[model samples]
Target: MSKEITSRKDDYSQWYNDLIIKGGLADYSAVRGCMVIKPYGYALWENMRDVLDKMFKDTGHQNAYFPLFVPKSLFEKEEENAEGFAKECAVVTHYRLKVNPDKKGALMVDPESKLEEELIIRPTSEAIIWNTYKGWIQSYRDLPLLINQWANVVRWEMRTRLFLRTAEFLWQEGHTAHATAEEAVAETKQMLEVYADFAETYMAMPVIKGVKSANERFAGALDTYCIEAMMQDGKALQAGTSHFLGQNFAKAFDVKFSDKENKLDYVWATSWGVSTRLIGALVMAHSDDDGLILPPKLAPIQVVIVPIFKGEEQKKAIDEKVSVLVKELKQAGVKVKYDDSDNARPGWKFAEYELKGVPLRIGIGARDIQNNVVEVARRDTREKKSYPMEGLADSLVNLLNDIQQSIYNKAFNFREEHITPAETWDEFVKLLDEKAGFISAHWDGTGETEDKIKELTKATIRCIPLNNTKEEGKCILTGQPSNQRVLFARAY
Candidate 1:
């Protein structure tokens, strides 16, 4: 029954690692920079994936998978992208491995099995996907190709964390093609909004919708739109990103479409994605020292019914009541679990459910049943109240909705209070070091200045918020003329 989690205040990093392992989310794998997502963790990811899949379908995007390996030639087609990911690319040179002739029981790459051309495990799907698009598009009729792929990608990260950064991770990358730059830009912005909506509504994590500066923009993209969320440790997490490729991939792969006038033009393109790192974001944003605090909408088990009983007769009565309650709750479209197993005591089950971040817990006992009441516990506020069982299902639904909004509001308020505005260099550094949230400051609009600030403070510009007001002010670092302010923070 002990909550053996590291205190967040003492060490945020250890707290995160402890919560992931102790809460049964994920564990370190034999691979250097990869993780084994346990069933409980995978279940959470599945719920997130199902919701995002439905959202993409509703937005005119169809799910179609692409190859995981890209030929070296096709991958290097886009020079900027190739150079950007060159450091992290994992290449396959030999196709087969054989037992060593000299060293018994040891496997070695067979010299005769060398491939004609090397292959690049996909870091992103732009190159291979655009190569395929070359054959798919011929006329203006194929104007917009809204395609999304749910797949795993490799990026050979040296410094790895459970769900945050790993060598290989699962993600959904959306690659779309358009006939016009305008349409492609619109699509990029649309997907950004979708991501923001999902983060705020489903994950109960508030985010700021913004555009990345040139230095922070994605490789081969003209503009990168992103949603940034502030974690409990006062750091920024890039929750999701949408890139406006602006025909970079199209031109590289010779993906052209003939207009009605018979003139061929390079097709415009966009790519946006959200990875399992979001699971880390959710944990950091609202989780307490006790354990995770998953939002109701995203939790695999929204409500868990834990029955309290004594002997055979009381246990039978509690089991019967739990069955009826479970049926009623499921009928009302609620994800509920009846944990009647006696492997653990009631107290142990309560602690386990809390660690798992189940939004609500209902404890029904023989005494409560006789009194026509049940004890309901809220994870977010850690509040418990007894209510009659007559209209329990409906009341629980409403309570879940309230908890969702409450969690969002709490995160929103934290972000609001933490964004400190700085007008001078001294103030910027002081706020970044002392108060560690977001620094809203004017920049000289140069990558050199941004790089200098990052070098000094370890804080980068999180984003230049979309629709940010244009005000005449001096750059906080350079004392040069500036128009609008950008957000800066140390990020994950």
Candidate 2:
């Protein structure tokens, strides 16, 4: 299985595809530009989703579902948002399909059953959600409505990757209503912090907390806050985003509420989301050429124990010891699996679990058990050590925590090394091509300059770092006066 994977040094793109396909994560689906996340991948997602869902609840948010299709009129309520997604929107015009008369066994859209109004599959849920909010909010008592939905969205992308840019993918979108602009902005920043924390703590991937420039902001948004992460290939990925929509959606949908002062005004709004694309980020950021290097916190199988024995009697002895260890690990709240199947050799099982990115693997044989020790291998470092069976479960608990931090530290160090400063146009271009990571350079703060830079080098301003320092400098391209530098990268 490991031989089937392409080395990252040989081809980064192919390497990613190889891992996703052969590492038991996902497969190309029958649907065009879509993927089928396999059981292993879905289990990983479930672990991630469970952690994030609890974080949302602890932050005073509630889960609620909404309609999958939005009425065309409602979708068009916000002109900028509608125009932004118009090219990708999939419309439903007919309610039913009938068998074609000329071609037997073939189905065709029944013209007579066409609906009076078209429905647009939601690319984002703001339009439909705010329309519903109009009926729900009527007074100051209903000032802040914090809701999140775990569902799938369609964007109809021309090109797609397994977990990165599919036409339809699973995600959790949070739409919120506040009574004032300040409140909405606060919510936006808060969610950005939440995303940054989640990416760093749970995913074990370091991210930069920043705000997007006007040209890159989400459509119909007053401001967009985001977290950016760098992959091992020196490319940046937008991990998550939180947008402050001001009163755009509220005004477009006429969602107004009365304050204590008896004044009626459109509600302020914010929306934020993180999707399965994070799975892509995780794979690219940490995995090696061998296979995936999943973080222990989010890995489906955090620990796997493989037993080695020649005959039934030996197998029974190893099983007895392993059963006790597994029970202890489970009691300690660890996701540990004992792979004692007879179909495969011990070495094959080791490679299979290693390719799957299990954080730690324990190998026990008759001799090792008699010696009162087991061989433990660390997936992140590929280091093996022997430990006594007694108190082994408690030791594994501490080791998992260490592995998580070690992975994050390695990624964080690489990111720190890749960020280089550019002072001139030639320098910026040279750095982008030769270095291929984040280039911090001054900008004239104009859309034309941003567009020209992207056209020239395919690098856009990922974000203006939050709380960025004020400094005197000249724009790298236009040589115009500038106040601060922003991060620029060719991204996914």
Candidate 3:
């Protein structure tokens, strides 16, 4: 199985790269900063996407798609958003490419086909969606247009990883139009809660629900709510974000609706999204040096059964019993696999499944069949146990549930232990020099102070936290009077 992954302790960064490449999750593509997600990895993503799709639908949001390209004029309508993404925007200057006249078999951009107006590949969909909303809304009845789009966006990132950051990536963006500021704000907070719930419940990763600092807010948003999770290395990852756009987009695009009083006003807006970067977060938070530690709820294969038999006479008997057990497990709503092929040894399959992070593994043999029992192994704690075949399916289901909880508990404990607080500038610098996980320290609540701290430490304020307690103290950096503490960490 060649499970030669680098030790996380030796080099966390290389360890992550080794896991992604050798674990069969993804591979580098011909493109410099893009990757090809393997079937194993794509299956993981499909499971995550399925759960999130249902969650969005249950919350009264409908899926609808918009254009991938935004006209340069429309994108510039919102000054802040345009300026924020301008550096990463990919532009289409010409319509077609022609064979080079000077060099045969080479293609060149056709100057004659240059477009009158350039189309910008969307870094985010806010500009194009809001422009279309101008035509979709005519009255109050059209308010609260809850639309979600599942698509890929390009950000032109210079440094790229398999899933964390790339030149292009897949994500779901929710852009909604609201009738009032209160509703928009409420929607933003609600989505943040949904993201936090999904992260903790399905990903088996705990997160901090908080409000982004002004300097950290979304480009055109008045307020940005986020769920931040800590990886095993003590770095923060922004799992998801929901922004209260306040009337900025609506005013920029002139999307107005008439109220019951017959007065017209701009619509309130919100945008929230979670990307495939989440896959990276899940891997970093749990997995060991051997392989991935996928949560049962999101694992494509929950349980896999491997047969340990010598010959056809013994294998046939074991197969008969294993087939029935497989059906029972599936009927019980378990994702189970029975590996009956002779192409590889049971040892190889075991290592492979362990590397894939299958929640549970079952081994059945001729003697075990005669004894009416099978051996089961738990991936999280690597504990092995024997159970009777009579109710093995039911017992395995319960075991999977426990594994999910156990993973979350371990991660939560790690996160709690890493969150260190510092009162003075010297202590803050020392703590961040170690960069255990998070630094909760008082800030003067000014962008200048935030920028200075980041410049000196390369650690930005992750968030202010929701419902944060107020306390009088001096700022860690400026020594100015402060009221509340903010979370500081180097983030992905």
Candidate 4:
């Protein structure tokens, strides 16, 4: 029943680590940079996966998988992508292991079993997918190959966090091929909107939809559209990204199709993905020092009913009343649970659910049952109210909706306030150090200035917001001519 999480204000990093470990979401694994997602965390991911999978299907994407390892030659086909992920790639040089002759019973790689060609564990699937697309597309009719795969990827990150940045993580990647540049661009923008919608509606996290700068764009992408969300710490987290690949992948893998006009042309491509790192964004966006504060829409258990009783007779009475309420809630399409077991006490159960981020907790005691009332506590606001049990199910349903909106409004307001405009170099540096949120500033639109600013402040351009207003101005860092302001922030 005691709150043991580190305060976010005192130490944000430690607080995040504590919540993930102590809240039973995930734990550090035996592997250096991997993690074992516990049941509670996997349940959360399942709900997110179900919703996203349905969305992909509704948008005409079919689920299919490819090999986990890509041949070295195939991986090197896309030059830009190859260079971008080269350092993070894990390669299989030898296929077998044998006992060390010097140290009996110890095992070591068998130099004699070296592979003829090294295999690269996928950091992303563009190379392998495009290579296969070569055979799949022979005519314009097969231009749009909409495929999605839910898989695990490895990026050998030296510095890792529980869910934010790990060596291996689960994700859903969508790779689609189109016949024309315009169609592929449209697909890219469409997926960006989808990510923004998912973040706002389901996660109760507000995000800015924008296009990444040239230096920040995805490797081999002409343009990268992203949904950037502000964490509670005033830092930016890229919630999702959709890339317009033009004909890069097609040309790299020599994937071409005969057009309807009897002309041969390379296929255009688009790829977008969201990963388990979203779980980190969910925790940092709205969670407080107490624990995670999940939106009602995504909370695995929307309502948990705990009975406060002294003896078996009182417990049975409370259980009888809860059964009716649970049935009503389930009929209304609400995820509800009745905890009547004696493994834990009422206080312990209350604290446990609170830490788990359950949206609503209902208490049914002998007195409340006698009065035909129940005590309801909301996780977002921590407000408790006594409501009549006659129509409590409907009341709880409406309250859940209210909580979802309330959490979103709170996050939206926080994000709005954190965006500060910087007109001068000193102001930009001051804002970054003092405020630590999104700073709107004019850039020279050159990679040199972008890289210089990052070197000086460790802040990067988050995005050039979509539909950005046009105005002549000077770059805050280099005093070069500029047209519009882009968002800059220290990101995760």
User: Best-fitting candidate, measured by lDDT?
Assistant: 1
Model 1 agreement with the true structure over 299-414: per-residue lDDT tens digits: 98999999898899998998888888899999999999999898989999999999889999999998999999999999999999998999999999999999999999999999
Q: What does candidate 3's lDDT look like per residue over 1-492, in tens digits?
A: 386988999999899998888778899999988899999899999999999999999999999999999999999999998998999989988999999999989999998999999999999999999999999998999978999999999998878888999899999999999999999999999899889999999999999999999999889999999999999999999999999999999889999999999899999999999999999999999999888888999998999999999989999998899889988998999999999889999999999999888989999888798899999999999999999998898899999999999999999999999999899999999998876899999999999999999999889999988978999999998899999999999888
Root-mean-square deviation of every model: 0.9, 0.9, 1.0, 1.0
What pairs collide in candidate 4?
Answer: none
lDDT for each of the candidates? 0.94, 0.93, 0.93, 0.93
Cα deviation in Å at residue 384, candidate 3?
1.0
Model 3 TM-score, 2 decimals: 0.98
TM-score of each predicted structure versus truth = 0.99, 0.99, 0.98, 0.98
The C-alpha stretches of model 4 lying farther than 4 A from their native spots are: 1-3
> Tens-digit lDDT track for model 2 on 272-372?
99999999999998998778899989999988999988788888999999999999999998999999887889999888887888999999999988998
Question: Residue-wise lDDT of candidate 4 within 387-440, one digit each (tens)?
Answer: 999888899999999999999999999999999999999999999989968999
RMSD in angstroms between candidate 1 and the native structure over all alpha carbons = 0.9
